[model samples]
Target: MRPAFVAALALCLAALPAQAQQRFKSSAGDLVVETVAEGLQNPWGLAFLPDGRMLVTERAGRLRLVSSDGKLSAAIANTPNVTGRGQGGLLDVALDPDFAGNRLIYLSFAEPRAGGNGTSVARGKLNQADTALEQVAVIFRQMPTINSNMHFGSRLVFDRTGALFVTTGDRYGQRDEAQNPANHIGKVIRIRPDGSVPADNPNKPGWQPEIWSIGHRNVQGAALHPQSGQLWTAEHGARGGDEINTPKAGLNYGWPVITYGVDYSGLKIGEGTAKAGMEQPLFYWDPSIAPSGAAFYTGERWPGWKNSLFVGGLAGQMLVRLSTQGEAVTGEERLLDGLGERIRDVRQGPDGYLYLLSDDAKGRVLRVRPAP
Candidate 1:
């Protein structure tokens, strides 16, 4: 091609969106990332409707719908009042397993309370025709609401047994409460669809009956392992030492007592990363990626990526792909680092492709597929 023609082509390519031209290669194959929708304000969670539309939660306490064709809808009405404080707000969304018939959806948010704010879960039916929630009810609320805004560990996932698992944080100022089973701070709680505690829960006498696990800092990412059916979570550390744990019934995850990280001021944290009875992480990162949403890839669209675990990194600004062998992570790959956007959530679409939400004032939903 002539030099003048080549110069014009370069300018055209430069004008295209970053995702349009940026490509990455994974163990599966060459991949391309493209923005599906934009203009979202610090979007956090995403769930799909039966008809292929998406329900997304904004950190500022708005829930909106995005059609399959990428059209964004106005905020759905009847959402509860949220604190929207630091690191808190409307966080995660999940549809009922029987959503088609029940029209039920669950939301996890930092709820405004009398003393202050706390993580709470609510369920409501989607009145599609009216664009509002019907029968909205707060199903569960974290105990002893505190004034702090940071560390509202809120993520929602449903197991095959129909129990809902909700993650809560240490409320920043209440890290010590993570070890206190009586309170809901910094814990994972499993409850029934109607907000009742399960009979088989491994509950301590004085502890909250709904708690499944404890000793977590701020768990924001959670999903079920596709094959093992175990619950896995990713939590943020103080300054460094981000961790991924497979939380189990009545297990202690060792947050303030045993951490791989230190205080933000570079002080030691909890007895130097190990203790006699505390559970260790399946994987961890030093220098902290600040991981958020997670999903296990079981789709056929990327054959080689099957069974992989995908985690979004906020501070690291990338998509983390962990190749798994059974219950253990065998390898890791970081995708979309060149895009330089804080990835907030990752999910596998029903169409078998990977989807992500960017965290920013002008956040966007992104789709990933095999390059042509």
Candidate 2:
């Protein structure tokens, strides 16, 4: 071959890997992962609209619409401002249960304050024809903004009764705040669709009325159990001891006071992982998988995966599946090990397939289906 011909052949071969589909075998069946959309910047959240389109959030405070066939629209207009510093940025997106009539949507983001930034929840009406949000309002803001940008735990989930559940972090330097219900930091709050405190919330004395549960470190993932309707969450640990807990009203989850993890410097954490009056994790991982977004697999695409809980792993770069028997996690499986991309968020699409958003500057939204 001539030199020019040989060079062209080499370039073509090098580009093949980038466009190839990723395949994996799991308990469900032979799986094929295809890139549905690309060019997203650190995509953080995924929500499907009633019309089968997808609403995605990028960590740098942009929202984009993805068509059913994988085409990505330009960033939607009038998104809330976000800090985008450290672990803070645009976080989660959730649609109203009655979105067909209301066209309402909710977003979680790191709002910039005077001294620092804190997690805030906002909702607006999505105007599809114009591709902009209308009447956007900040409904809830975490209290006591701190200087550090790590651990802005934010995930939005609506319970069976249509109330909203918002998870929060301990704000990095303030682990002790997890045990304090007086503030929104390190707590899971339950509120009405219009951001009002529910009258039935466990209103302990001196605690914020919005607080539903306390003592969380950095709860990055939350889902409503498909069968039992309980709220399950996944939180980060220091060196080891990532946890999955079923948070209940007025319960403490024992973050700084009792942890299975140690300090980043290898020193032991408080109380050695067990303490009285604090709830134990339903499941936990040692050495830390850095779990993020989560969802319950009630879809029919994978016959064997019904009722399974799926969690995205950032540091592990895999999808974590937990087999649950009622309230207990019976088994665990890690998928997409070979692709080696950080899974930022996972959701079950209306078509009954699993959708994943990769966390990267040049991120892609992937769809998982059984191979034909």
Candidate 3:
């Protein structure tokens, strides 16, 4: 074929969107990228309702439902108050395992408290009308809230046993706090749906009972492994060193003490890349991609991607697919860089489709389907 012909073909393929010309090529196979919804302001999180509609959170502190047909609902009434500062606002949302019966849902947000602001998790019931959250109460609060507006590392995940796992940041300015499990900053906390600590938790003397693991930086993305039932997280590093970690209870995942990246100022960070007792990451990315949301694909829509882990990127503005073999990341592939949007979250729909939320002033919810 002539070069001009090949160039024209590429341009035509690049025009794919929600309707005509929706097919795009990927290593796995051909994929049809469809715009399920658009015009969301910095959509930060997404959760599917039992009936098939989606609950989406805008970073500016509003919660809306996006119908499958592409209609976006008005902001749901009575969402908990949030602090919409730098990286702070309404964040991740998750439905209760028994949501069909209890109508309970969990939300993680940057909470404005007396000291300043910090990440907090709350639970509320979606009323029958679907217009409001009723019986809302904060289930967990980051202790001794700092004055900084950054690093409210948060993502809500529910394990197989009804336990709620909350991930937190080091509150930016206080990186040292990540090493100390006594405080909530930079920790993965495990708690009951009602905000009570589990009796079987690490509960180390002098340490907070809710802490499941420690020494994490700004871990914005997390998901439970479909087959292993283990919790995996994607975390942000300074200049480099984005990491994927499968957190185990009471383990310390060296942050400042043993980072693969350096400080933003080009200065060395931590003691080094290794330590005696700290846990090493399963994988790390140099020139950090600023990862945010994570999901494990167990669906059949993309057979080539089955059992793979998908993570969304903010700084890198793409979707990353990591081939996995039982908790091990074997290889990595970056997708959607041409979309030119910051992927804030990734999800797998019940019907075996992959969904994404693009973060921007005019964000979009996109669906990826098998193309003919």
In order, what lDDT does every prediction score? 0.88, 0.88, 0.88
List CA RMSD, all candidates. Answer: 7.4, 8.4, 7.3
TM-score to native of every candidate shown: 0.93, 0.94, 0.94
Q: What C-alpha lDDT does candidate 3 achieve relative to the native structure? A: 0.88
1-372 per-residue lDDT for model 3 (tens digits): 365754554343233346422566689787777788888989999998865678999999999998656788999999989999888999999999999899999999999988799899999999999999999999999987899889998999999889999999999899988999889989999999999998888998768999999999999999988888999999999999999999998899998899999999999998999999899999999989999999999877777888788999898988899998887899999886577778999999766778899899898888887777
Compared with the true structure, model 3 gives a TM-score of 0.94
lDDT of 2 by residue, 1-372 (tens): 465754554343222222458889888778888887899999999998755578999999899988745678888998999999888899999999999888999999999999988999999999858399999999999999887888998999999999999999989899998898899889999999999998889999989999999989999999999889999998998898899999999899998898888999999888877889999999998889999999999966787889899999999999999999988999999898887789989998766778899999999988787877
Compared with the true structure, what per-residue lDDT tens digits does model 1 show for residues 203-265? Answer: 877789999999999999999999888998989988988988999998899989999988988
Q: Which ten contiguous residues of candidate 1 have the minimum total lDDT?
A: 9-18
> Which sections of candidate 3 miss by over 4 Å?
1-23
* Model 2: lDDT of residue 31: 82
The positional error of residue 183 in candidate 3, measured at the CA in angstroms, is: 0.2
